[model samples]
Every structure is written in structure tokens, then in C-alpha cells.
Target: MTKTVAHIEKVLEVANSTSAAALSRLAASWRRSAERHGLDPGEHRGPRRLEGTHLCERLGAFEKLMTVAAPRLDNLYSLVGQSGCAVLLTDDDGVVLDQRISAADTAVFEAWGLCVGADWSERHEGTNGIGTCLAEQRRVIIHRDEHFYARNTAMSCIDAPIYGAEGQIMAALDVSSARADQTEAFNRLIGAQVAQTARAIEEANFRAAFEKARIVVAESDDAEAATLLAVDDHDLIIGATREARRVFGFDPLGALAPRPANDVLGRADGPTGFEKAERAAVIRALTRAGGNVSEAARQLGIGRATLYRRMKRLGLDQT
Candidate 1:
């Protein structure tokens, strides 16, 4: 097995050996941190589906989301020294779901937004991100020089997969930094914390989208199902089409939806003629010029700042 996978198996093995009280004390920060990712603290009981795994295997946002995980687990990694990057999460299939890195140190990972939506299948990129976690189903840390990707070899990452009630692989959580210590204690702490963070997100998504009486997150399996679910909820949802994502600059088919209707407008229906009237005229000229604010300003006989002000007032997705 690769280093990442081997790490996961070992973490699980050791975690299983701990008592329930001990584990809870160990993961206390995890429970509190999940609430930040939009999960209810009352929901997380413990690692319920973590056993009976000899036969089976599996695994799995935001700056707003990261703020929650950071304070809870900060002491885990940065105890001795600072890390270049912090937490990461991946979906059930080992796709790099979302990341939170220090803005000052972001360039190290942003070679091409390396931690956002990148898949971690051994077949795709290599044994990185949660690819090896999906392979091993536990917490693992592939520190600097242990990574298989030549470019990623300089980085150290600790990863763990979280599971749901049905024992399905929900997500993966990770913490990373460029620094390496001979002890690797920080990796162990941060990797375990990341796994707890994923567990929290899974629980949050379940409570928010799945249990909600009205709201529904549209999954990609069937467009028809989303269409059917969104019948009377039109005012609440923006619909699950590429047009909606592109119109708003939102990543398409996302679970952590952007601002809700109440956030965008006092009332659901915008001014009936607003888009086609003043805003429409501005947008038309802007679109004609291919979103060139300066050109659109000249076409509309307005200053660049004036054009920008109008877009914000109208809440146009793109200027």
C-alpha cells in the first residue's frame, strides 16, 4: 500500500484501541468544530459506524466553513510551529471538495487552485488528497517527501475519511504544512482532527438539506428529480441549471448554496422590469462589450465607477 493508505489503516487501528471516553476527550474539539460547518452539535454522538470494517472500506468548504474548523483544531498542528496550510475536505469519491489555506501562504498550493474540486483517484492525479484515504478508510499523514506526486512531494498532508449513518464514505478531512518534524506528532493530531471535521460536515449537510422540510440540495444523478423537487420552491431555490451557476458565478451543482432568497432580496420577486429597464440597459451594453466595464461605460456614456456602482445596486452577477 502507498504511504497515505498505510497511514489511514494505522490510524484506524490505533483509534479503535482507545476507549469511548478517551476518544471523546480526544475529539472534543472535533464536536465543537462541526457546528461551524453548519452541523448541529447535538447531532454528533461519536464514531458510530467505525467498526465491523474488516470486510469493507470507503471515504470523503469554505472560508466561512473553515473559520469554524480552525479554532477548534488549531492547537493540533501549530502547537510547536506554524503550518503553511491548514484544513482540507474531499467528497465521498475522494474529490478535493474544498480547502482553507492561509491567504498569505496560498501561493504554495494555488499553483492551479490545487485543493478545489480536484479528484484524488489513484487513476486520476495520484495517491494524494484523499485518494489514499479512500483506499484505506482511516487517518493518514503523508508528510513532506513522502508524497508520490513530484510537485506535491515538498508538502506534508494529514488525511482521514469520515462516514455516515449508513456507513457510506462521506468525506475526507486533512491538515497540511510544509514543515516536517522528526516526531510527526502534529500530523497525528491534525489528521485525526480533520477526520472529525469531515464527520461534522456530513452531519451538517444531512441536517440542513436532507432533514429540512422545504430546502433541498440538487444532486447530479437526475435533473428530473431536482426539477420535481423544486416545483413550488422556485422562490426559495434558483434552480439546478448551468445557467443559474454561470449567471451567479457560483460553482454549479453545489451543496453549500450561495446566499438565499431572503439574503438577496427583501421579497422574492425582484422589481418586475428592473432587469430589462435600467439594469437591463446597462447589462446589455456591458454584455455587448463582453463584460468590458470601460468599454461598456463609454457605450453607455457613463464613468467606470458609475458603471460599477450600478452593477452593485442591481446585484448583477457579473459587471
Candidate 2:
């Protein structure tokens, strides 16, 4: 095994019997190294579009908005520091558009295949910050136990969706990480920032869909127009806003779990737009893990060998 992987394994050794906080020291060490060399996760990807010359037509507007949002996001991401904070932006289809992250969490992010060009639609990718936020159509802050991918269980993720002018689901925003200083307050703050960013984009378009999913309300610089609603499958709405009731066609009483972007719009049995090769790969990963590699894997399934292979293939940190 490479030295880095060996080191991470050692931490896992202690972690096997220690608290989740035990991983902080290793994260701190990796953070220092990643800072000097830089580990830019997430691939800067283009939107998924229908075939034809109209591709630009589908992407141009969102692209412009993301470009504008990027700088402010950069400012926001700076607050993340080395706290294992990772920020990601995705279109309604769950294709990642942009992302930013802290150095401490770089190794883990890359290991999970979070590059910009990656596709995270629910079926293929399982449940995660980006996918769950998009699928559930509500802001979610998942820490540990909530992860869908067994290998990802160790992570703490907070994801919020963005919206366009008419309230269409434009995209989703997510922050995933594992480290010290991870708290509910921190999660709420990030969720709120993402919500504001979504609303800013929404003012520009109304046909937005998942962009409206799970969008948290940004801090009220003035009298904010956004609202936060909780919904499940029933479309019953609950929570803080006239905007939420108006935007999502929610019932006043029922609620299940609404991941709007992840809604099964097509065939229920088979995979959806984002489900394909990734699903097969995840299955293979589970099978290969033999169910013993938590840190090396995601929620649970991770073997030293599998982790090494994935790291090599995905160009993740050797350590």
C-alpha cells in the first residue's frame, strides 16, 4: 500500500474503537499537505442537454448564472476553512456544475468520486448530500447515519437546492465533509447561504424546478422573499413560508419525504436519467467490499484493496 493509504489505515485502526472525532488528527495532517499541493476535487461540468444545436440554449442561461454565483460562493467557501467543508452546485438533473472545498477533506472527496463532471442522480449514485437534496426537494443536512452509500456513512453532508425565476428546480447545492467543528449551527449557516444563492438565481427565472428543491433561506439582508417548506411524497407542506406554499404545489397537511429533483418521473422499476454505470459500479463495490471497509468505502462496504483500486482509478490521494 502507498504511504498515505497506510497512514489513513492507521487512523482507521484507532477509529475502529474511537469516536468519530478521532479522525480529526488525520484530517489535519492531510489538510496541511493538500494545502501545499492543492487537491481540487469536483470537475467543472456542463449541463446535461438534449442532443442538437440547442444544447447551448439549454445551458447558456444557467451557465451564466453559475458563473456569477461562483465568486460569491468562493467568498462563502472561504469561511469553510479546513473544517472538511465541501460545496457543490448541481443542475436539476443532478449533474454537478461546480464545487469548492477545504483542503482537509480533499482526500476523502476525491475518493468518493466527487469531481465536477460527475453525475449524481439518485438511482445511480444512491443517497448523498447532492442527490438526496435534489431528490427530496428539501434542504438536508446529513451527518453520518443518514448516508445512502454504505461507504459514505462516515461523512457529514448538508445539501440545499437552488431555484430559477418561476420556481423550477434549477439546481442543488451541497456541502459534504468529515472533520472537527462539524455542528448543527455550521450546517444551518451553509444551508442558509445556499438558499440565498438559489433565490438570487430564481429572481432571474421562474421555470426553475429542483433549483427550488430544498433551498434554504439566505440570511435576510433585507426583507427576504424566500421560504422553507418540508415535504414528503404526499406534497403536503409544512414550515416557514408563504413562498414555500406558493412555489411547491404542496398540500397544507400531508408530508412524506420530497426530493423533487429525484422524483421518479419515468419508469419506476428501472434506473432514471442518472442511474446507469454508476449503479453497476456501486453494486460491484459492495460485493467486493465483503462488508468490512467502512472508512475505506462509503456507508459501510470498503476493503483495503477496493479502496486502493478506487483511489488509483479516480486519481485520489495516494495516502
Instruction: Give one digit per residue, the lDDT tens place, for model 2 in 1-319.
Output: 8534444454334334435334553333223223332322121232222434443444564686676667756766776645667777777877666779666667777666665656666544444667667766777776654443345556677776765433456688777767645777777777777666555544433223333332233222234445444322222222323355454444433332344423522336664322343334444555665644454255323345655554443334433
The 10-residue segment with the lowest total lDDT in model 1: 224-233
Which residue pairs show backbone clashes in model 1? 60-90, 60-171, 60-172
lDDT of each: 0.48, 0.52
Task: Name the Cα RMSD for model 2.
Answer: 24.5
Scored by TM-score, the top model is: 2
Model 1: lDDT of residue 211: 37
After superposing candidate 1, which stretches have Cα over 4 Å from the reference? 1-82, 180-183, 209-319
lDDT of 2 at 211: 35
**What lDDT tens digits, residue by residue, belong to model 1 across residues 1-319?**
7755554443333334435325653232222222222322222121112213311222212343334334434443354234555566665666554556667666766553345555554334344545566666666677654443344555676776654322345566766675544336766766555655554554444333333322223323322111111111223433323322333344544442534534433435654221334566777788899988999878866677877866776777563
Off by over 4 Å in 2: 1-61, 204-319
Q: TM per model? A: 0.40, 0.46
